[model samples]
Target: MTTIGILGAGQLGKMLAEAAAELGFKTHVFAPDADPVAAAAATHFTQADYEDIKALQKFAASVDVITLEFENVPVAPLKKLATPIYPSPAALEISQHRVREKTLANSLGIETAPFAAVRSPEELRRAMETVGVPGILKTCTLGYDGKGQWKVATPADAPPLPPGDYIYEGFVQFDKEISVIVARGTGGEIQCFEPVENMHRNHILHTTTAPANISAEIAAKAIHTATTLANALEVAGLLAVEMFITRDGHVLMNEMAPRPHNSGHWTLDGCNVSQFEQAIRAVTGMKLIAPKRTAEKVVMTNLIGDEVNHLESWKKPGAHIHMYGKKESRPGRKMGHVTILSPRD
Candidate 1:
């Protein structure tokens, strides 16, 4: 059996391991953590610091192909591996930095919120002139799940600048937020799952409804934009494009994650081919399969913080529960999710 090496053993990696197993592929999960959630799902778990080049070399020698569950994994170490990595280090590098990501999107003619890179107080002040107040200040790297972000409602509201590069984005009045999961094969073929409308609570994803209550035209446009981005990046794996639909009916690109996304979790129970399976196929050079919704409508709700305590309450017919097997459940941490399927109207 072919062995697949996965980087970052989080919930995403756990799901990826399960999918790889279902497809008869052995998964080797590598991370610095002593015990990761994905270890249970993987055939082998390599616990070593990412900086340990010798450990990475041994891990690479054991796997046929390598892919990452998260983009924050150090690209330098992976570059030295003889094993092939899907999605390319270049694509991962671009996704890791917000400035590079936004610049790439804008250059591709994809509409995005006005943004400026600020490295110091003076640069931030200058950026304010163009982005104005009521903008978001985010670190150029390593920000996710509402972390490393500050809202600037007014000039005085701006927090003391941290010692690093940042990106300032003008706030947009959007009608709804949606995400498109586009999968690209090694042969350059692309397939997109239906767009899903997302709702966030306290800057963290709360719920997602597939086949978003959107006009066919808007959905088509969103899918097209996501596919175009995946192709432009020359990505050989799944790309999740989060977009904002304005009240004026225009779709603006928000962010891109070059892997399985929280928004696509609904596909696990609602689609014939789940995002996890697609990721495995993409990285292994298999033909990309278009995901077909098995249900008329599907709703996925995240179990965050103490929400996991009420897991039993969400257990009902047509509801699928997925727990990440995490021991500690702290505030704002994702514990698991529940997906419910509904008949089409």
Candidate 2:
């Protein structure tokens, strides 16, 4: 049996391990968390810091191919590994930094919110002039789920500059936020899931409606943007592209995650192939499967914070509930999700 190595033992890792097992592959998880949630599902677990070269080497030697559940994993250590890792370190590096990601998208002629790199107050001021006010100042690296982000409604709102590179991005007057999950094979073939509409509360994803209520033209454009980025980045795994549809119906790229995404959780119940399975298949050099929706419509609602407590209430016909097995529930923390498929009329 081929062993799949997974980095970052979070809920995403747990799902990946479960998916790999379903495909008759064993999974070995490596992470720094002493009691990682993913360890229980994986066949083997290695608790080590991301920067520990010796531990990473040992872990790499044990698995046939390596893949990551999240993009924040340190790229430097993974670069030294002899094992083949999907979505390459170069792609991971670009996804980690906002500046690099945005620059790459713009260079591809993909539309994105106006943005400028900010290193100092002076540069931030210039960025405000270039990107405009009503923008957001976000750390170039390590920012997610609204963390490491500061809203710049005006110049005076700029707080004491933090100690990292930042990118100031102009906000778009978007009508809806949507995301597409594209799986690319080692041979460069791309398969895309239908675009899904996302709703957020406090900058954390709250709900996703699959087969977004949009014209076929708009949906096609969204998928085009996602596949374009995945091909441009040479991504060999799943790439989830979050995009915004402006009031004028134009699609502007928002962000990209080179792994299974929270938005794609709907696939677990609504599609023939889940995003987790796609990630594993892509890294293992398997042919990609077109994500055919098994349901007419699917709505995935996140169980956030204490929301997981009501898991029992969500159990019903056409409803698939998934709990991440997290011990504690904190505000804005993703505990699990419930994917509900709408009955066809």
Candidate 3:
């Protein structure tokens, strides 16, 4: 069995472990927190700070292959890992910061929101003037699930005269948000799933409906864009690209995650080979299966905070709810998610 070391212990990592097991792979999960959700099912696990080089080296020494759960894993440890890491350290380093991400996107002839690097109040002011108000301020590093970012719809909402560094991005006045999830085998075979329309609540993903209602031409563009990006990044594992579609039908690059995305979670029961399984195949150097959605329309809803505690009410036939086994429920925390696959009207 090919041994794999996963470099994060979030729900993504947890599900990846499950997929790896089915393929006869032993997974070693490493995270900073003790007894993470992934640790529950992973064959082996290590709890260590992400920056702990010694711990990372030890963790990497044991596995034959390494992959990451999220893009936030620090680049240093990934570079130090003994085994080759998929999705490429190059991909992680570029995708980690918004400034770098947009730079790369722009370099590839992809359109991104107008943005500028803000390391001081002056830079922020100039960026505001250059990019205009009704913008977003995001920390260049360590942001996810809407954390580490803020929107300034008006000048009053502006972040205080900034000593702290940030990336200022122009707000996109778009009609909808959509995402494409793709898995690229190490041998370079690429398989893509249908694009999904995403709805957000307070910057947290509320729901994702697959086969997103869009023109066939637009959908084709989205898929082609995703495939091009995955290949361009030399991505060797699962990757998801978030995008914004203007009312006029222009597609703008939003950002990306180097693992199975929240928007793709509906695939758990809605597809022949879920994103989890595809990720496993990619990282294990196995061939990827052609994606086949179980339903013409699939919807996934996240269970946040106390909503998970009352899941008994959501317990109904046809509703597949997954709980992360988190001991406590806090506001905005992703306690679990539910996937529902159905035919389109």
Candidate 4:
């Protein structure tokens, strides 16, 4: 059996492991955690820190193909692997850094929010003048789930952050935040899922509704942009493109993820082919089917922290509960998520 290796052992890796089993593919999960959630379903588990080059090399050798579930892992070492790593190092390099991701998006003729880079107090002042107040200050690297970022609502509130460089982005006047999860095979076949409208609590994703209330023109643009990015980056696996839909109906690139993203989790039960399957197919040199939306209205709610602990409250019919089997949880931690397919009320 062909074995696929994943570089992270979080919920994303768990979901991917489950999907791989269904498709008759073995999954090898490599991570530093002693008991990663994915290891339950993983065909092979290699617990090693990201810095352990020897362990990584051994894990890479055991799998037929390799892909990463998280983009935060550095791309330098993974590039030296023998097997093909889907989405490629170029894609990881771009998505891992916010400044590079946004800059590449803008260079592709894709419009994003007005922004500037700040590496020092002086640069922060210049970025403030350019992007104005009510901007988001995000670290160029290692920022996810609203961590390593801050919001500057007013000029006076801009903190004296001179430790490291960050990216300053002017807030987009958006009606709603939407995302499109697109998959591209090794041969350039692309499959685009219906846009998903997202709601965030404390800058962390709270819920997602599929078939986003976007015009066909805007949706088309989103798909086109995602496809362009996949090809441009020579990405060989699934890619999730997040966009800020302006009040005027224009789609502005917000960010891109080089893996099975949180926004696409609904696909597990809301589509014939889940995002995990798509990622596996794309990386294994198989054809990626154009995703068919399973629910007319797919609504997904993230069960974060204590939210997942209250499992009794989510017993509503037609609700799919997927607990991540997490041993512990903390505030703002992503414990699990639930997806519901019901009428759009």
Candidate 5:
């Protein structure tokens, strides 16, 4: 059996392993976590730090191909791995840095919120002026789920800038936030899932509804933006593009994830082919198929932190519950999710 190596052992990795098993592939997960959540589902597991070059090399040699569940996996270590890794390290590099990712998108003629790079307090001041107030300052790399972000409400609200490369982006007044997950095959064939609407609480994803209530024109624009970035990056795995739709119907690119995204979790039970399955298929050079909705309407709610305790409550019909095997839940931690499908009213 071919062994697929995964670089992270998070919940996403667990789902990918489950998908791989369905296709007759064994999963070998490598991560430093002592109790990786993915170990429960993966066929094999390796506990090692991402910087452990020797371990990465051994893991690479053991698997037929390698892929990552998260974008923050160090690019330097990936370059040393001889095994072919899908989505490419270059793609990972760009996705790791907010500045680079947005710059590339702008170069591709994709619209993004006004942004400026900041490496110093002086630069921060200039960026705020250039991008305008009521903006957000985010670290250029290594931040997610609202971490490493600070909001600048006014000139007087500028806190002491943290010491790191940051990007200042003007706030966008949007009607709705949506995301599209696109999978590309080795032959350059692309399969895009229908755009989905996302709702956030405390800057963390709260719920996602499939087939966003937007005009067909806006939907087409969203898909085009996603596909354009995927093709430009030559991604062979899943590339999820998150965007903001202005009240006037303009689509502005938000950040992106070059792997199965949290927003795409609805696809697990609501679509003919889930994002996790598409991720594994893409890395393995399999055909990418168009995703068909299993229901007219689908809603996926995240079980954040202690919310997992209510798992039993979500067991009603049409509600697909998935709990990550996390031993403890802390504030802002994602414990699991429940995807519910129902007919449109």
Candidate 6:
């Protein structure tokens, strides 16, 4: 059986492992420590620091193909691996830095919020002048789930700038936030899942409803934009594009994640081919499967922090629950998710 190596052993990796097993692929999960969630789902687990080159090489040698669950994996170490990595380190680099990501998006004629690179306090001040108040100051790298982000409502309200590069983006009055997941094969074929409307709580994803209540035209445009980005990056796996739909119906690109996304979790129960399966197929050079929805509608709600304790209460018809094998859950941490499939209301 072909063995697949995954770089991060998070819940996403766990899901990917499950999908791999369903497809008769042996999965080896590598992380700093043995992640029970991934280990339970995968065939093997390697516990070693990412900086340990020898360990990485050994892990790479054991797998037929390699992929990453997260983009923050060190590129230098990945380059040393003998096996090929899907989505490419270049794609990860672009997704790692906001400045590079937005710049590349703009180069592709994809609309993004007004943004300026801020390397120093003076530059931030200048960026404030350019982007204006009611903006967001974010680190160029390693920011997610509302971390490493500061809201700047006014010049005085702006927090003391942290060390390192940042991006100042003018706030956009968006009607709703949606995300499209596009998977590209090595042969340059692309399959885009239906766009999903997402709701956030305290800047963390709360719920995602597939087949977002939007006009067919807007959905088509969103899918096209996501497909264009995936093709431009020449990514082998999945590329998820988060976008903001303005009140006037214009879709503005927000961010891109070059892997299975939280929004696409609905596909697990609602679609014939889930995002995780598609990612594995892409990386392994297997035939790509079209993402066809098997349900009329699907709603996925994240179980964050204490939400996991209430899982037993959610037992109802048509609800599929997935719990990551995490021992402890801190505030703002994702514990699991529940997807409900139902006919259109």
Q: In candidate 1, which residue ranges exceed 4 Å CA deviation?
A: none
TM-score of each: 0.97, 0.98, 0.96, 0.96, 0.97, 0.97
lDDT of all predictions? 0.91, 0.92, 0.86, 0.86, 0.92, 0.90
Count of backbone collisions in candidate 6: 0
User: Over the stretch 262-305, how does candidate 2's per-residue lDDT look in tens digits?
Assistant: 99999999999999999888989888888899888999999999
TM-score top scorer: 2
TM-score of 1: 0.97
- Model 4 agreement with the true structure over 216-263: per-residue lDDT tens digits: 898898888888888888888888999988878788898898999899
List model 6 lDDT by residue over 4-57, tens digit each.
Answer: 999888899999999999889999999997555787888999999888999999
- Candidate 4: the clashing residue pairs are none
Give each model's clash number: 0, 0, 0, 0, 0, 0
Error of 5 at 313 (Å): 2.9
User: Candidate 5 residues 1-345, lDDT tens each?
Assistant: 399999899999999999999999999999999988999999999999999999999999999999889889898988988899888999999988999999999999999999999888788778887788889888989999888888887655667765888998998988999999999987789999999999999999999999899999999999999999999999999999999999988899999989999999998899999999999989898887789998989999999999988778898989999889899999899999999999655
User: Runs in model 4 with CA error above 4 Å?
Assistant: 153-156, 160-162, 343-345
For residues 151-268, write the lDDT of model 3, one tens digit per residue.
8765457656546558989989999899999899888899998899999998899999987989998898888778878888889998899999999988888898788889988888
Off by over 4 Å in 6: 34-36
Clashes in model 2: which pairs?
Answer: none
Error of 3 at 59 (Å): 1.2
User: Local error of candidate 2 at 222, Å?
Assistant: 0.9
lDDT of 6 at 157: 66
